[model samples]
Target: MLIETLKNRLVLACLILIGLYAVVSIGGTLFFQYEPNSQDLLQANTGPGAVHWLGTDYLGRDLLARIVYGIRISLTIAFFATLINITVGFLVGSVSGLLGGLADRLLIGMVDIFWCIPPFLIVVMLTVVLEPGIKNIFIALGLVLWIPTARMIRGEVRVIRNSPFIKFARLNGAGSFQIMARHILPNCIPVLLTTAAFSIPDAIMAEAFLSIVGLGVQAPNASLGVLISDGLQSFRVYPWQWFFPVLTLTMLVLCFNILGDALHEAYSSKAKGLLEHD
Candidate 1:
């Protein structure tokens, strides 16, 4: 019955989107063959044709191949970066909420400082100092993006910490680590999933924006943002170059957002039901 509620249209759609992304990122990158960086001057700026399913870009590289590679690259970076960001957030937020003292104040103050400043400005400065590269961009993005996740975890932890089950565990002589690992952490799972899932789209969007402005992945690497930027130059002549990449980015972002939203809603409903039962 509970599972049925979660298997609604939105959840199914989310699954489809995730499956598509996985297929494109894994299968396309591994099985599908074509060098995204290899250029052919003779084939440059050509419209879609039999040979090039999507078309050839300004450098005469295969647009389809670049798009596939771009999908893989963007998704790969976003996934890992989000993981890093979430780990940072989880540690800081959990410690703050669980300990709750001078430490909490200090950690929350740090979060405030980062939250007050525009993350994009920080990212831009980091790129200037760090230079445009895959790993650096990953660090820059993951650094600036953790504040929100921290806040979410802190809020959820504080609420879950006060639950009677937590008190019972404390009464049962469970250590702080045991209580957190078994009691608080399990209860906070929904918030963690929702927060982390939502962060994926934001990370992807930031990477795209930075790449478009030339502060992202450098040349010879295929990024959706870079491809979109390149296509903008010749869009009037060859629209497919720009159109396909933009379409892909939009759909990817939309799917991530919807998936996160659906997860959030489902979890909220389940939590409410449990509370009512209690």
Candidate 2:
């Protein structure tokens, strides 16, 4: 009943839209060649028209094509970064939470140290040291983003570790690893799942920030961030340059956040019901 109540139709619709956008972006890149960087002096800066729907860029590059390609790269980076964050966070969090004393203290201290360092500042520092590119952006963001997730997971782990089921498993001669894998880990699902769902938008937004700072998604790549940054130079005369890319980014982020929140509420409600039953 709680799950049913939390099943938001609006969120479901947004998730479907996000999925569809991903398919179009990926499929278009694999099958077509619209030339994201090919310039045409004759067609430069033309407003929305039949030949050029979204219009051409400052260099007369196809806006639609660039937007499509940009979406693919942005989404890919976000997905991979989120994956790394989840894997590292879950492992670190679970281990720390399941084991108290020295191990927990060390992990907690590390997390606190990382928390003191701002993520954007870390990314900027890394960009200065490391070569700025798509891959580097992912590595930098993943390294910093995992800290928060690890903390969240660790907190969840502490709660789950004390649950009755985990206690029973431990009493039945289950080893620490076995208790974590079979009992504690299973209960930690709600936290892990929600953390992952929330991380997607954060990853996407982070990528945009990194790109805007001139340290990510290099020239001719056409990430929405790159597009917006380039367009901002001519915001007064050619507004479309900044308008469409920002619009696309806004929609994408909004959809992901809505869906993530919906999933979070659903799982939280489910967890609450389970606790009540106990």
Candidate 3:
């Protein structure tokens, strides 16, 4: 399965792009001379050249540096937010599914309530209510973005909980925790990976939207959305400011989406094959 997934050209290409972005975002400081926040008034609004590869923003800050750093910030936030999202969703869903009865009903009911509300609206409200910063953004995203994951996980766990292997494990004296840890979770890996892949881009876009509206990652610290917002002022005159950031953001999101689709396809095919064999 792993070999076949790697053989997929679209999946391979998206992986490479995502890897390049991750590498640049993580180790960019080593390669770039300019700091994202560094300013040079004289060089402000300059076009792409030897000194500034991508160009300069209105404040004469290096656009390339800012974009790389922005990518880093966005990825970092998304990574952590997704971690929180997965952890919370896993706990809620697994518990609800395993316990069943009233607990399942209550938990699913709560999740359904959240599911009905738009995630973006929930995130926006949370960000507005809480302080505006990376931590708050993480919290807001973590809290709102787990609904789908929870619902999916709940269904998956419910099905798995009744499987022959699970019944065997229970007969062998395996506790709920042991069964969940050793058996159930391993079975759910495909779902978790696919959900996580999709969730990351959702988080990235959400953060960008929040930043665009001046509710996320304040000035001096550049996020793609922050750069785009600033660039809109000079968009007519110097388009590079927004163009590069927008392009990078688009590619980043696209790569994740494609990767998610690839993973879903791979897993679905594998499942179908197993079912046919059975």
Candidate 4:
């Protein structure tokens, strides 16, 4: 079944990478327990050797330790923000699609209005207004990211509502909530899940960009973005400072993208099968 494939390959890979990140994040607290911001200029700029696996930065903090913690924080932000995006998107889309007329028109128009605004600009402006921290980053990213997701879900919902299944559900005297929950929403799950996978990397990169601009995760809290920002200042002298964080971030993003693509294909195939069955 499609579920088996998702588990065997795409979902499994994502889970494994997520698990590795968790281990690095949680294990560090028990072992190194190195304060990510505690500076030790004496041990600064050391390359990977017997002691440090990824080496120390200009501040002499363990790069590996900081990155581990940073990944934890970065992933946390992405996961939660994306969750909020999907929730809002799904709700708005479902309502717009299931309830046609002026309400649907107004909702769809609002989503389009949101889509017209540049997401990055909105995030930057919000970051400027809000106090900097992990939570603020989450809010900024979620607020902007939901627009695209809502658009996609709305499109999908519009298509599904016209299908025979929806008509059948309505003919059975099903309530709006019952029809959506029992028929429309279940059909939309694969699309929603795939879209969610794609959103994670976007959220991650957005967080990094926000941090680089000095509005994201504040000092003392480790984030891949903040780490890269710090690394850039000394990039010429300590190329390793930039190299490792960038490499790790690249791999994480790449993995998520690949997983998203794979899920999308699989979902499309499943969607096709469901149609055939109907």
RMSD of each: 2.1, 2.2, 1.1, 2.3
Q: How close is candidate 4 to the true structure, as a TM-score?
A: 0.90
TM-score of 2: 0.91
User: In model 1, which regions exceed 4 Å deviation?
Assistant: 1-6, 29-33, 171-173
* TM-score versus the correct structure, for each prediction: 0.92, 0.91, 0.97, 0.90
Minimum summed lDDT over a 10-residue window in model 4 is located at 1-10
Tens-place lDDT per residue, model 2, 73-131, is 88888887887888888788888999989999998898899899888899788876888
Best by lDDT, which number? 3
Write the residue-wise lDDT of candidate 4 on 145-211 in tens digits.
Answer: 8887777777788887887877887788988889878887787787777777888999999999988
Rank by lDDT, descending?
Answer: 3, 4, 1, 2
Give lDDT per model, in order: 0.84, 0.81, 0.89, 0.84
lDDT tens readout by residue for model 3, 120-206: 889989999997888899899999878888888898898779989989999999998898789878888888888889999999999
Candidate 1 residue-wise lDDT, 114-182, digit = tens? 999999999899878998888888888888888888888888888778778888988999877787788
Per-residue lDDT of 138 in model 2: 79
Candidate 2, position 68, lDDT: 83
In model 2, which regions exceed 4 Å deviation? 1-6, 29-33, 171-174
How many steric clashes between backbone atoms does each model show? 0, 0, 0, 0
Clashes of 2: 0
